[model samples]
Target: MALPPNSETERGVYLRNVFYNTHPTEVFSTWPKLIVEDYAVVGRLINLYSFIEINLRRLVESWTDADLLPKGRIKDLPLGRVEELAQTVLLWPEANLFALKKMAELRSLRNLVAHFGMMRFPDDDAFLFIAKSEADYKKQTGEQSVEDVMLIAVLDGPALPRLVQELEGMAQWLATVTAQILKQKADAEADVSKS
Candidate 1:
């Protein structure tokens, strides 16, 4: 069911970020390479990215599951159902759409790199970049040599760090969303009892 206007999902974003201990810089510095150098850093990176990948897939699946409920069924939704969903997915559309979409794209990049040889890499393995979308490629500049991809080869690309930051932020959002959704279900049940 849809959330009420006053729910926590409506928390001011600044406040929400503060509440979540989620300054992007804080999360970024905690990232693999930014935090360290060498194989250990790479290992930490793989772990972080793997965490994000598995959970993101879980998130989409949970959303699809929650999406299956008929409208107005929050009251009818079994207790803890939303919690189950939120445990695996983000509850917000805006953040999930942008951040998770990019992360999934990053995962696809990793997949291609791992499965294919280093020769397939655009320039070198030194950085990772990607096309925003196939349509982005289709829209070329009038006569210039336009490329649809946004390359992260530039200094401080934020591609890897951004993914880590988003994963952490979304993880935080999942908790709040779970609580809010559960509360909504409980409130709905109370309303039904009163009527």
Candidate 2:
């Protein structure tokens, strides 16, 4: 039996069809299979985000007081918020501007991946990460054209692994800088006590 045009399944099928310029049934049949087959790519994307988020959380926690902001609270902070707090508090002299910038870029890319959908054209094999709805795209980026979203990264491309490596490197850099700052603070406190 065919579902009525007003049925929930029919509504879901065609809601975003205008933007893709494709029949709803094509998307309905292909999207699930594409997503499932690309499960490993999804895992890599998630892991890449986690490496940066976890490190940023740790850096923020190291400086924030447990009484004012509990460890669990810090852990739960959004990636962008944690990045902002880490930037404000961690003032070591050896901080790398490039790495910090890269971390910010990673946060933006992670947001896009989390909020948008990945799609590939019938003729093209490269799945693009893009906002499916025009309204949502405009709301997120304040741009009228969904085309402005840009081809930032591919789902299964070499860029994903490279980003993972870069994030790991940044995590190491942050850990070293945090340790040095803590040591300096402790040493200064000890000196003051002895004097």
Candidate 3:
């Protein structure tokens, strides 16, 4: 379900309350308040990204039962490799390929957010640079020139909250997938033991 329209306002109020609760004596200036709120959202995105990474790592661990590798090797694996392993090693059904595809998309966005700095051009605005959607590429097909290939898209103030909501939904979906895979692994092991 989508968040209520006032969710952003609600989040701002909650942050303000928490800040005041912690540093009761400090007065919040408007500029610093905005900075704090902005960073708080960024922190949230990074935290959710970490959650996705952990779940992806768990899926990778669950895929293999053998202890041939060193202890902590899986922990050292990067997100992209983990994702690739999950896609290749997991026994996903034809109907569930959508999850893997969505994962690939998420992986790209995660990389962009994790690695790139948020840039604010003085004449324009502050925005998160993301990949152009497939639909965007399609719209430019045949008319595309050497300079026409659009790789970056922008997300400014109004869209960040919605992006957070979408990421939360994705995290939930991935958790469900990981749980199902782990359960299947356990069931298979149990069946082998019973035989």
Candidate achieving the largest TM-score: 2
Please report, as a residue range, the 10-residue window in candidate 1 with the lowest summed lDDT.
116-125
lDDT per residue for candidate 1 within 1-195, as digits (tens), equals 111122243323333333245444542344233223423333544565565544434433444545643345343444235334433344447755565454444444344323322111222223322233333234332233345323121112334455455555655554455456556666877898999
Q: Please report, as a residue range, the 10-residue window in candidate 2 with the lowest summed lDDT.
A: 1-10
TM-score list, all predictions: 0.33, 0.54, 0.54
Question: Which ranking of candidates, highest TM-score first?
Answer: 2, 3, 1
The 0-to-1 C-alpha lDDT of every candidate, in the order given, reads: 0.40, 0.56, 0.57
Per-residue error at 150 for model 1, in Å?
Answer: 23
Better model by lDDT, 1 or 3? 3
- Cα shift from native, residue 77, model 1 (Å): 24
Candidate 1 Cα outliers beyond 4 Å, as residue runs: 1-36, 57-93, 112-167, 170-195
Query: In model 2, where do residues sit more than 4 Å from their true spots?
Result: 1-21, 31-38, 65-78, 91-95, 119-122, 130-135, 141-158, 175-195
Tens-digit per-residue lDDT, 1-195, candidate 3? 111122346544544344334332232222122346666767777788788888888877875553422356688786677877766674677645666656556555455555544432222234433233445444435344354233333444656666777778877888898898789878988999999
